[model samples]
Target: MDSKNKQQNDQKKSTKSNGNSKSQSNQTKSTSSTKKQKQARFGEEHEGKLLEFFVEEVKDIYFAEHEALKALKKMEKAATSKALKDSIVQHHGETEEQIKRLEQVFELLGEKPSKKKCEGILGIIKDGESVIEDTDDNTMVRDAAIIIASQKIEHYEITSYGSLAELARTLGKDDLAELLEVTLEEEKQTDVTLTILAEESINEDASNE
Candidate 1:
């Protein structure tokens, strides 16, 4: 009878331990759920700030393209290849159109075109200047450098336009977003064209030197 009583006591102790383990497991799950909720809220807040940042970045891109036109004109002069020169000249006109689009975007926003120094574009243009001034103005060398410089500018503009489009959409400016998207597409195409030109002609000729 005493042994049976002890067996009942052991069974009760095991049952109690199992209940405590289940309770701890449930608590841990609840804590994890709370942490996930907090993280989701934080991500939403961060996304809002990122959209605002892109808007400001688009404004900076406006001025960056303007500065790019000036540098492009210099590049046109420095270019030794006829095709490269023509491409630069054509892009200068395109850049002007791009600026006009940006102004339209500003007007749409009930704002005026304003200047802000874009350190990124400034650095790119400065690098182009160094390439133009330091490199021997040989046909091959100039074309190679021009390819590198022009592609860099195109990539930057593409990124800026794409981001601006996303921001505009987030802000419910569908028309503005569409406009920026079109420009972004054009910039990407231009970059692709440059790549094709470089591959089909520029690099081959440059290498022959």
Candidate 2:
């Protein structure tokens, strides 16, 4: 009788252990499935208010870039330093290319490339114009002023592009993100170039004046 009771208890323990193992395995599978679903949530259809907002922001930047083109032309003409003028001209060309990229981004979204005036950029441009007005032309001080104004614009672009790129990724629009990131990098490089020009000679020359 003792031997039989011991065998029964051992069998019960084995069955309980097996049951726990199965339960744990099932739970793990459930957790994994949930994780996969979450990962694939933004796969294709990005129809939401977020997307609408993103599109509007893109349009804003488009208008801002157009305004920047005009501003760059003005700045280039106002600038006395050859280096500053050349940099502005180069960025002006890059701004054109950036607009083309934004057009492509609109195409990907099945939308036409449209402009929505960005008051923020408008204000910044106005400030830049003020800088030019306040400083004397054909002087290093004007060049320094131009550099400051240009950097402000670059910083704005950086913020816009960085935010847009992240939003694109969240929408699972990797291609759009790539395009925005490229422009973001360009803006950052432009800012750095301006800084280098300032530190190398523009600022010092202006101070002497």
Give the whole-model CA lDDT for all candidates, comma-separated: 0.82, 0.91
Q: What is the C-alpha RMSD of each candidate to the true structure, in Å?
A: 12.1, 10.6
Over 1-209, each residue of candidate 1 has an lDDT whose tens digit, in order, gives: 25698578656655655576777757755765686588669877977787557557767998899898998888888888888888888888888998998888888877778767888999988997888787778577788898799888888898889878888887778988998988898788888888888999988988888
Model 2, range 22-74, lDDT digits (tens) per residue?
Answer: 78757755765685576457433444778999999999999999999999999
Worst ten in a row by lDDT for model 2: 38-47
Q: How badly does each model clash, as a count of residue pairs?
A: 0, 0
TM agreement with the true structure for every prediction: 0.74, 0.79
Q: Which number leads on lDDT? A: 2
Off by over 4 Å in 1: 1-55
Q: Which one is best on TM-score?
A: 2
